[model samples]
Target: MLPVDAMITNQEKLNSLATECAFHRFSIAEIQAATRNFHNDLVIGKGGFGKVYKGRINGTRDTTRRIVAIKRLDSFSMQGAAEFMTEIEMLTKVRHSNLVSLIGYYFDDNEMILVYEYITNGTIEHHLRKADAPLSWMHRLKISIGAAEGLNYLHTGVGNQQGVVHRDVKSSNILLDENWVAKIADFGLSKFIDQQTSGVSTRLKGTFGYLDPEYYMTGRLTRKSDVYSFGVVLFELLTGRRAVDTSFREEEWNLAKWAEKCVKERRLDQIIDSHIKAQISPKCLKEFVQIATRCLKSCRKKRPTMAGVVLALQQSMALQEQYDSSPQSASFTHIVQHLFSGSRLNSVVSTSASAPVTPIPHRFSSPPVTPSPHRFSMSPKLDKIDPVHLTLNLVARATQNFSPSLKLGEGGFGTVYKAELPEGQLFAVKRAKKEHFEALRSEFRSEVKLLAKIDHRNLMKLLGSIDNGNEHLIITEYVPNGTLRGHLDGAHGSVLDFCQRLEICIDIAHGLTYLHIYAEKKIIHGDIKSSNILLTERFRAKVSDFGFARLGDAETDGAQVVNKVRGTLGYLDPEYMRTHQLTPKIDVYSFGVLLIEILTGRRPIQSKRSPDEKVTLRWAFGKYIEGDIMDLVDPQMKESLDIEIIEKIFELAFQCAAPTRADRPDMKVVGEQLWAIRMDYIRNGRRG
Candidate 1:
């Protein structure tokens, strides 16, 4: 919201500031005549700032008239006044190719208007979702790169060694000209800081879904916030979705959160808009996702500088160019096969701004199926892999006595090593030193008992245990891909895809639900996070490491008790953390946090988040209230998401993470809900 600079209360001070700022001044009557006395027909756009009218003013000397956009502030908006002053101040001293150019200003006792050169083509947002024609991939890349360069200039190119952070960066703020060039506009929320000084802490203010979690939590508006917002715009270009789409469910209301899940889960193909997905090469897609993801990191220090972001995007653009002309690329017919649907080819995309753009169907919704809670699946057959005791020598022979080369990864409990058994079969051996036998023994006992009793497609299968009083080891069928944490941590070099991630989630829910009800005894998995969830080569999720698990009697709420609570901090149940009551509710709460992690691509405990913002659910809950939960979604998962289904998962996750334990749904119900979500997505062609 910005007003005309000349409309300040102190006329003398305004005049002085204008003289010092070096901007042209205009007469109030001249402006009134140009806009036809602010006629409604002349009005071109309306927003929070107020009405904007298209006008033609006489040139300084020539007979030719200049077409301009005149913006008038709403008297009720104090924010508009502040923005006007800042825009006047900033636009005068700083200049760049990618930013909108200010022409002159007019103000008097009852009238205030700022004139800017008219941008003929309108906003990037307009060409994106509102315009009749969809922007091609090259156009999308061009606009994004231009916007990034402009932002880079603002952050560092401003004279006097100052830093300018564009607090509100979105598609609508990026104006496009007749040539389709990008021009960043709206300096209302911009902040200027000295290069030598640290950032100033101020009140948090930004549009929903585009706001930085770190800035919103700490009130520290750094350059990284702009980078985060730019990253969101990049997502918009990639997904062909809005930053905050209300038509979507609450969880998907914010595109960033949903996209992050797609990137982390390696499901970019499933979420990207179909129109542009083919235009990008897989390599460029990876590079682009990497840069966007880096920019959206919760920690400011972790996010790349605008300059770095620009460089990375340039590299991605180069990669796209390589894809365009490469002989190895797919033939035109192959790519064209996916360009249009059977009947959409006949539809013409209109270009009239007054008329609404026909939206291409992104994803379709299916009838939701809610399964009965009474249904339960028993362990298929434990006889397939019974708990066997192998000698230490045999375990050592398979793993070469814990060779470093064969080591898969190390966890809190023990180190996992890949082993080739005598039968030439691959297996993962979890081992601990003799010194930590007591703790390892307890974990081993719990895992053996629970895993031995249960057998399900989604549950991790235990093969044999070796305990010769020295080096203890537990053997299980080897998974080549490693854990979900490994993929999330970027150690695997590739992420699980969207469909795979959802499938994994369904698999986990099935396993957890089985343990909660179908097992010989109802069990509570005290700890459920990404690391504990193993992944197969196909990215199938298998519930592993039941060290903190316990037998729970669902019949009696207080039947199970614990002297001390044991669980991950952010994933830990708040009520369970306080009451120390070991119940199925605790497992439900932990699973809820896991669901958030899966959806948001964030760690359970974000160390860099502000003190009060330690938990992802808390931040998510706040955005949920603000009605832009999609902001928490990943940037990679763009157009492919089913809006309604994403909201259901988020609602389910929130309910699972509810502060009140009694409000949490049972694991059986959780499993059914997750199944329903997957089925819904499948119906929407998620697998395709």
Candidate 2:
């Protein structure tokens, strides 16, 4: 029996956990009501630790009832209180569609219970073993991909939290929903891993058949162990047999070992489940078998990480989909003929291919008689090929012969001019400078290509372009309120409120998040600074300047070697500058500088300031450490500031600008954090 003090400490920890997680805490009365006084009829499933009861619980905010699975602890269960608490802690911190969600919990009157979003269907184990019909090839692929994604999310940190290793991974724990969507459940044996830590030291704890061979030999548990177990599950899916079946021959008892041997012998077809044997595409099966076998390698180092497993699984799925979508020779010939039709080519070419824009009739019959301060020497080849081809004469006339008064701003690419057509339609035209025309032509085309694929409210919109042999110009929607730098400098003749600044920061975060993760192709917005962010009349931010952007994958090592670093000096990532490695984190680091600038109303660098305050990040960080960061807040906005919001923003800024890429959170997390801060500010400010 534990001492009184030990019992009190455990209770205190539980109280803290209840407060930290956002899950609803249920009263014992509510639990009994939901489960009908623990009726035997409601018991849907039973396990070593508890019986899962399908229960109806009315939501706190609404009258609508929610069906949930309530797992109640048994008196003689194998799992004790510690395992229960661990499961609660793990589920609350990480959230992803592929992972089971914890709805609420009850731990009153010596009764420990967990409530989960009820999966309509049952466990993958059930379908694999006792179901009336075998899972189809497509269904199996979808389930495996979803399960792999959930494991990947656990192995790699989600949002602001560090990664959690789901120590117990098997087909039994992978639950399927009504739509056949896979959700990884059973986090009782999970462990959280910090960024610097490779693995944790712990006593061996896993099912016999699904245990990692290396982990079994050595008690040290790592993410690779989870991968090994997931590999065993894959083989179970592959062979439609239990992980360890004594009825099978001795060599075939262990699924992982048997599968590995079959793969090595190139005789995997012998064990392929007859149901999916003919359905599986040769290429997909080959890739699937290779990745699964690699996961079962005895050496932990040789085992693929969960993330690698996910990528491989996704690739295999894609291959299978392509095979499914392939047409016969006769159908393929017809498809080619249909694709070459003139109307289809014209409509699809604008977005999918580079088709020269059909030139519109010029609003003005002739060019302006007077040459403005900004002059564009006309190119000889005016109608040269490119997407969104605007006639040179129409653009030149719209901008009043590139008038100095109409010019909005200038960057490495060229000067931007606000153009107004006769119909009063406004557009921002970016005309390449004469001296750098030849050098920047390709860059101009790349930017056009990148912008064509982009479609986000927070990102600048691409209207059209003009590319003659000598002159190159890109057009976009005109943002009337001007750049963020202008507002920060008070060029707008109004001081921005604290709330407005916070909104602007959130908008920028949204834009960056989309660029880094949600775009059709992942992009690194190589340059991010106050000047690059343009504001709409309502103070909404639209991130512009894709001249230096690069197309890259965000999921791999996330680093690419660059011949030369390109970005505004003060906002450039220090690590990128020092090592010449480019990644999405550079934009994150730049955004950190922008955040500090927004709060302090100071430029990233102030040469005239004293040595201590010359660099805003350095000085702001020092003040942050001293708990006097409020001293640096913009004086005009200080009156409406919430201390908590200020601290959180500054804290996030510093985290983004941390010395190494590993220390920085991804843009998606940063966006979520900013939104949370905004909500907190709105709530707390009202209270004040």
Candidate 3:
């Protein structure tokens, strides 16, 4: 029996799962009738979780009855309420063709039961071990692809929620339907990954032979742990052998270790299942073995993601199909060479299953080649715009060989150059430094991937990019008016009035709102200083430089641990620096400092000022609390400021710069309050 505290925790989790899952609830009598009073003759499957009985029940929203699998928990079962509620929660939220569907559940009178859509065929382990029929190579390939897709969906996640790790992935969890389509079942030991956490530490929970060695030894579980277990299942499908057999010698008992040894010694032919050996193509076998071995790598990080596994399996199937359609005398090498000669295989090989998958950026002509017009199209979000790629030579010519005279300013990772193309169109080209090439290249790739997906008026538009041998460039639409910092420091010839400053702040707020909530994925701008903000000829603000941007936290706690801190010093959130816990509120804190900078026309920090006024936010906040908010306004602004509106703005700034993220307002609320303040300022005819 679970401890009192453990049972209470399980009950809380069950209550939360119940809210998201809206399946039918059966009474004890109905469940008993469906399972024929728990008769042994009706039992179709048995596990640590107890017996799964084949039963018939009326369909959901239909009069006709349908076959269902009713899982009844035994009184002395190893699994308890935790596993029961986890399955209900996961199945209700995720719906995929390759995953089994949950029909309903019953938890009355201490008799816990889960009803699932009945699969015509039994588990993969049953076919491999018990059935007289042998699985053909093609059938095995199809099953592998289907099962891989299901696991990929679980790891990649459903919508915005964190992904799930199937801690118990094995042959028994994969089922087949009438058409032989595979369906992954049994979420009894699954765990949801925190969005920002690389792995979770938990008590060991999985079958012995299929468990990841790293996870078993260290108890640190990750999606890669599931990848390792699925690799064992792949070997099982390939060799027609159980994962563990104590009858075999000590070393030979473990299939993963033995198969890895066979692969290392170049003796793969000795381990191929006799039933499918003759039907397997050499090319297909090679690809399958490559992916399977990668999945079983000792280091968890070296294991391929489930999506990568699915791709490799699909490629193997395609190779087998191609071989079947061709003559026996056709050279496998020739076919592979032909496929690799095309762009599809070239691109696919670049994003290998063993490496992290990233969107392939469009490469363009450098020197010594005639440049052609390449359509730089992005997906889903940027589908509405048609962008043209720029050649490196053309960019070089426009910027006068990256002349210092054409230099705009320097950014976090590179130098910004102003350019005017032959057609008279203006642009800003960022050229990365040669020193620290690896880090800069990573930042370059990160910025490109992030900029490609986002398309907003207040967000800087990514025009094109160049990645020649030693040169890396990012080209964006040039804002002729320079940066917000330049204008605030009078480098733009005149200081911005209060009304214009309010509009600029509002624009920044709108852009942040879109990034945090409206985008396909929530993004946090790690560095949100005033210098990173740009202005058009009309002084409209656009947030730029996504080098420090990251996907926001998906954990319920609203904060994620970080290994390294990145941001401007003065505008940095003190809490983030102190604790190394990142949240969207860090950006709000920076924005608060920017707000003070806008009102006062000062940098975040000024060592030249007196000790009491050195740091702008600290000094302004102190004055604000003392009811001297009017003194914080920019003395250069000639217009008379409204005292009521000034007090409200200062109050909001303090709220945004709260000591802790929990006390700060989300961007949605902050934007709304800013809009209200602007309206009030205008209502009193206080527009500068």
Residue 439 Cα positional deviation in candidate 3, in Å, after optimal superposition: 47
List TM-scores for all candidates, in order.
0.47, 0.55, 0.51
lDDT of each: 0.71, 0.76, 0.77
Per-prediction backbone clash count: 22, 0, 0
**Candidate 1 residues 412-530, lDDT tens each?**
56667898866676768887645556855776677767766777778777776655444456676677777786676567787656677778888888888888888888888788878
Top candidate, metric lDDT: 3
Error of 1 at 154 (Å): 0.7
Order the candidates by TM-score, highest first.
2, 3, 1
* Model 2, span 223-308: residue lDDT tens: 88898899888888888988889898898888877887887788978879988899998867877887787778787765656655
Of the pair 1 and 2, which is ahead by lDDT? Answer: 2
- Give every collision pair in model 2: none
Best candidate, TM-score: 2
What local lDDT score does residue 230 receive in model 3, on the 0 to 100 scale? 91
Cα RMSD (angstroms) for every candidate in the order listed:
24.9, 17.8, 21.2
